[model samples]
Target: MDTERLFDRSYERVLSHEVDGRAFFEGFYDAFLAASDEVAEKFHDTDMDRQQAMLMKSFYHLLSFYASNNADYYLDRVAISHNRHHINIRPALYDLWLDTLILTVRRFDPECCDETELAWRLVMTPGIVYMKFHYNRDSIVGS
Candidate 1:
């Protein structure tokens, strides 16, 4: 998948104004909301909207950690925090995120959709669990 290269391209696209990173993030956020809505419906919970918003904030914090490009501390922290939060860590949420990313990439550069998907798949390797909050206490928590 050449994740490094793909990340480079993604950054380039963002920096060069070829694609609006903010807009892409918004789409990703919307996907999270939709996934959370589905999960809430399945569980017959009415707090899905609030849970989804909290997850979005947590994801933003993770993104900031990644942007720092420091030690792998953020990875471990994210992993542990995700395990603790348990609302943002669903396979269905990941599927929704991937779909949103694919659509965003296709909208900006149709030719890069395949590569973007490949890179995304590599970044989200098997055995990696997404974060979700089971307790309301962890809803506002972020890494």
Candidate 2:
């Protein structure tokens, strides 16, 4: 699916709803903390309110990046910030992140469907891939 359609669905069905947005992030964080020890430990000291805000912004930025074509600047910074040497988000962890996000959407989104899930995946994949790619490169180059 194209990013424009995906963004439209994401905005109208998910992000634009205030209560669902809160529920979605709550579900995502709860599921993420329970998914693995590594994940749990990573966020043990983090400020979740701030983290959630950042996630929301980053998610929108991801969608906008695809929708606008020149808005990848934020995503590039996201990749750098999440690189292994910094936040240490590994490539493998992105799978868990995506899974939990989709599960959260299913649980919280009023209009959740296969297409909705696919749109989330399609919108999120590029950012995840970019993060993972830069994470790997930083690992190699920084070492």
- Candidate 1: residue 89 lDDT (0-100): 51
Which digits, one per residue and each the tens of the lDDT, describe model 1 over residues 1-143? 67757855764563344445454444444444565666445446446556556645554555544445332444455555544355335545555655665565555543466677676555443223333332224433343
Q: What lDDT score is found at residue 19 in candidate 2?
A: 58
Candidate 2, residues 14-77: lDDT per residue as tens digits? Answer: 5445453465666578889999999999999999988888887887787676566543666776
- Give model 1's TM-score versus the native structure: 0.48
Question: What TM-score does structure 2 among the candidates reach?
Answer: 0.80
Worst 10 residues of 2 by lDDT: 134-143
User: What is the lDDT for 143 in model 1?
Assistant: 38
List the pairs of residues colliding in candidate 2.
none
Q: Estimate each model's TM-score.
A: 0.48, 0.80
Candidate 1 overall lDDT versus native: 0.50
Segments of candidate 2 deviating more than 4 angstroms: 1-3, 15-22, 69-71, 139-143
